[model samples]
Target: MPAPIPTKVHYHKQARELELGYADGQSYRLAIEYLRVFSPSAEVRGHGKGQETLQVGKKFVGLKDITPTGRYALKLHFDDGHDSGLFSWDYLKWLIDNREANWAEYLERLEAAGASREPLGIEIRQL
Candidate 1:
């Protein structure tokens, strides 16, 4: 099957969101934190099946920036200092397709673990 063309793409820096438009007339707005927690990299996704890590304390995260990998993918830099995930067209589609269920699952896991998505381990010095 031939690849579908992208109609429009926008990155909102302050909002830390990526919006994509497709020729099929569907658009998606994805948060940087959502993409980070669901990264396809071994660092985030692990190397083997059933090894996915439940990323916590990342609800407030956002996208730092995006670097294009030619025309096929984007290298995402995350606010939590995670820059390993390279999102391709196919992967992005999968994420879009599964956003609702996956987000619900993440929330359920956090609740079950008695975990908070609040920030952790960062010391801020206020003068």
Candidate 2:
């Protein structure tokens, strides 16, 4: 079976999110920061397991543009200068399905490294 294609793809700059709507009446919102941190690029995912680089201080990263890669993937340009990842349709679906767990795991990894999502010199406001 082929991976599903999104019927709608809209980037909401004000919300800093990408909204995807499917044919089955399902929809998902992916934060720009989340996409940047979890990019499938070798720089982020690494060449092999256990070699992945931890992406920190990307809480404010923005999407500069999105370009299609043939018919199977998307090339996402990040304002932070990263644009290597090819987000395939399958990968996008996987991201949406595992978003919650992935996010939690990312936070755990950051905390373990004593890192903050906030960019350098930016203070994290505690409520």
Candidate 3:
């Protein structure tokens, strides 16, 4: 089967989500933070398998912009200064299909690494 092609893409600033509409009538709303952590760049995915880096302290990270990379992918510019990942159409579809599982795995990894999603110096102090 051929991969689904995106028919429309919209970034909702207030919701901090990238809404994608595909040719197969499927749509997905991906969070900015999710895109940041799961970036397909070498900085995040690393040089090879088992070399994946854990991204931390990006709970509030936002998208600066998203530019198309030819007809195959998108280059996302992040507010936190990460701008290397090329988000392809197939990869985007995969992300939408596996969002729940991927998010759970990310949470598990974060917990194992003793990392917090919250940005640095921002503490949730209880009164």
Leading candidate by lDDT? 2
Q: Kindly report which residue stretches of model 3 are placed more than 4 angstroms away from their true locations once superposed.
A: 122-127
Specify the poorest-scoring 10-residue window by lDDT in model 2. 118-127
TM-score of 1: 0.83
Give a tens-digit lDDT track for model 3, residues 11-122.
9887889999877787889999999999999999999999999999988787878899999898999888899999998888788889999999999999999998988985
**Can you give the lDDT of residue 105 in candidate 1?**
90
Q: Indicate whether candidate 1 or candidate 3 has the larger lDDT.
A: 3
Task: Pick the TM-score winner.
Answer: 2
For all candidates in order, the CA lDDT equals: 0.79, 0.90, 0.89
lDDT of 2 by residue, 1-127 (tens): 7679888888888788999898999999999999999999999999999999999999877788999888888898988889999999999999999999999999999999999898998554422
Backbone clashes (count) for model 2: 0
TM-scores, all models, native as reference: 0.83, 0.92, 0.91
Model 1 scores worst on lDDT over the 10 consecutive residues at 118-127
Summed backbone clashes in each candidate are: 0, 0, 0
Pairs of colliding residues, candidate 1:
none
lDDT, residue 40, model 1: 84
List runs of model 1 lying over 4 Å from the truth. 2-5, 121-127
Scored by lDDT, model 2 comes in at 0.90
